[model samples]
Target chain A: MALPGFLRRERIVARPGFNRWLIPPAALAVHLCIGQAYATSVYKAALVEDFGTSQTAIGIVFSIAIVMLGLSAALFGTWVDRNGPRAAMFTSACFWVSGFLVGGLGIETGQLWLLYLGYGVLGGIGLGIGYISPVSTLIKWFPDRPGLATGMAIMGFGGGALIASPLSRQLMSYYDPAYDGTAGTVPNGDAVAALFFTLGAVYLVFMMFGAFIVRVPAEGWRPDGFDPSTVKQKALVTTESVSAKNAVKTPQFWLLWTVLFCNVTAGIGILEQASPMIQDFFRTGDSSTVAATAAAGFVGVLSLFNMAGRFAWSTTSDFIGRKPIYMVYLGGGLVLYVLLATVGSSATWLFVLLAAVIISFYGGGFATIPAYLRDLFGTYQVGAIHGRLLTAWSAAGVAGPLIVNSVLDTQGEPGSLVAANYRPALFIMVGLLAVGFVANLLVRPVASKWHEPHSDAATTPTPARSAAR
Target chain B: MSTSVSKDPTPNGQQPVHTPAALIAFAWTLVGVPLAYGLYQTIKTASTLFTG
Candidate 1:
């Protein structure tokens, strides 16, 4: 006898390889586009020189962008769940491209507000949407390898800066002909305009590639060679399916949010002022000029670590469980921050090593969280949940820069960053990481109320239906 | 043709069901334009932010 309609639907859903290979390319495209955020620091000197703006004023642009990223993610996440990844990604691409075009025009015209509107508002929305597009889709497609899948995608996000940093620098050099061999002085006018227009065109193509390649697997799809029984073998958190609405109500979501917030804040503290921070730390009176150049390279090097950590540490979470991995991220990160605060300039190598490790954990936290959600919430509406969770990153992006820049600005030191000046901020980062560690420990298995059990008819076994196989 | 028929079985032990092209096209249409627009905006936003 033929199987029931529901059973047939379930079986069809279970079919594997709904374009698994497509996930990586989609993720890389999005990351490459969004990764431009990393290159913001490169433009800071130019902005300061051209418009004669203070670092604080320029810093506000990034802060606004970060805030908007979080806000837009929280707002659009629900729509993403309802409409699917394609819609969210598409919307992300539009806002991102528009933000660039407008911001470019603003630069040419010297309208700071227009720059804020384009880059901060429009670009921020793109960041949020593009950020979440491939995460949940990869998880669903690679249920047997959720950590690996999500890690690959998230790693792309971290590493995107590696490519973007160089590309932006090159573009700035090419466009800005008066590039005196200064570390942070690029004259801004038509050259800036041309650069913006070019990036806008290129990124539009890349982000659209990601959006086009994105596809939801037919429902209930599982890896072809995988067994559902293996869920019992893995130490990973694995929950039955839950809607995004219900997932948010659980304490686990809040705890994870705190963890992400803390991780991002700690990392941003170093990231936002890396060049200047290094220059200050290593300054020995007459050695300041050499120190500044070295500092820029240090900033670039951190980007490498940030990118590598996103893949290495997060991929490791597949074997060791997300909760435990996060424990290391937070706990180990706390100790590193303490070392940074206490050792000061005397322990220069230690400081660099510790900073690199902490930043990696920060990047890893972003890469791993999607898989973490997949384990705790199931694939039902993970994309939306991931989007909602990213608000924490948005918060951190603002808080991180504010803490670092505000502290330094108050000190009013234009030349170099002294060890004594950074102590308070280092301590704050340490405290944040400690709190995140506690939150990770508090995370419990998801309660049963959230599971969307497959409908009874869908779960029933077919009778003498060998023909369908 | 006989071999192919022998290897494949319809769910009801009869002819296979095929999803219509128009339905697929409609679904794509619902998603395609919005996605394209988002990409455009992302590029526009980033370029403007950095350049401006």
Candidate 2:
């Protein structure tokens, strides 16, 4: 029987003014704010001065925030799917703002625990929820353009830190002026507190924009001209929807997890220590020279590349397929890491170029994976699955910084960061990427058992289903 | 792919039909107001943190 006309109108109109172009920008607004997590390094100096804390201790704040982001995403992914993106984003805004306010209070009171609770726990919730809200919806809206759609959102995430780093530095400088006579001294903690509050407020507004604009396409709707068969032209792993519980049981999930972990770890290792690494590599005994500023600018330049690559490479995945693009990320990344280990200090530009490329892949990996999940698991439960997969990111966040920092810290002297200093870390990244490369190759098409065909008729096997027999 | 494979045939189809403007407005309020309020609180707190 044909469905009623009123029902059809209701269904068609539910799709609203939604188009592919709108989805990416909506995703970008939220992603850009969450991406500020990348800029935490820029604030390290300020934190150390204000709190009289060690670098390792401050690093824990980032670590906690990242872990919580994964955990919260896993916990809330189902709620997002049920209640929709608006609810999730609103919740995110609340937690994120409270985190900033609470963190500011902590800073003023010189209480490190509050800082952890505020920024790490509360803010992390915001990151996780905000991060996943737009992904599945955008994919559904642009089934034909999953890679491009998700990439646009994820690109904002990667580039967010590019804007944040400069903004944060400026805010820090404005609030905490350097004392002329005192080395490494910061002004009152009040300024820093004020800055955090301002950031929180601004982030809330941007995130709200994302929440307001985002809407899910009505069920079963494809773009007017798209053909689903074209999705197979790119990758072999595409499958119908699988529940999140089932997705976790599959080997593909684990393999993709490893891929994301290796990519993130390798990129973050370079990014976290970029400024200091450059200073140590090319120090010419002039502490106040233009070289120092130039090196910082170089780090900023890498940020731009990292940001652009998220959009560019991930969008390319639509054409070339996920597994092949990852081959480039792992294989090309390994070569770059090797070059850095063997001949990095020989020329500064080589190190910069290689680092920029690796970081881009790292950011690209994040931006691309939501679409990849949509391909592998189907859109039915992808948001939850994506949320669950983020546990890999939390793990990488810890592993990357640990490998880089522990190796460097163990070397003791600041000047000891010569080519030899990073040899072990670089090799470790290479080995990790190789492992990921193999894992990517092992991925196969999802099996029939995982597909969630609606209604019991799927199981009944009518003559239409049994015709081949 | 064989015709037996068939495209997804779930009710409402694969694409979402148009959402009522009222629903969009309602959804926007659900997300937007809290966020704006949060921002206001953040700004207020920041000013206090800096000035005080």
Find the candidate with the highest DockQ and give its number: 2
Docking quality of model 1: it rates as incorrect
Candidate lDDT values, in order:
0.71, 0.73
List where candidate 2 sits over 4 angstroms from the true fold: A1-13, A176-187, A237-239, A283-290, A456-469, B1-52
RMSD per candidate (Å) reads 8.5, 9.1
lDDT accuracy of residue A364 in candidate 1: 89
Per-model chain B TM-scores are 0.58, 0.57
At residue A171, give the lDDT of candidate 1: 75
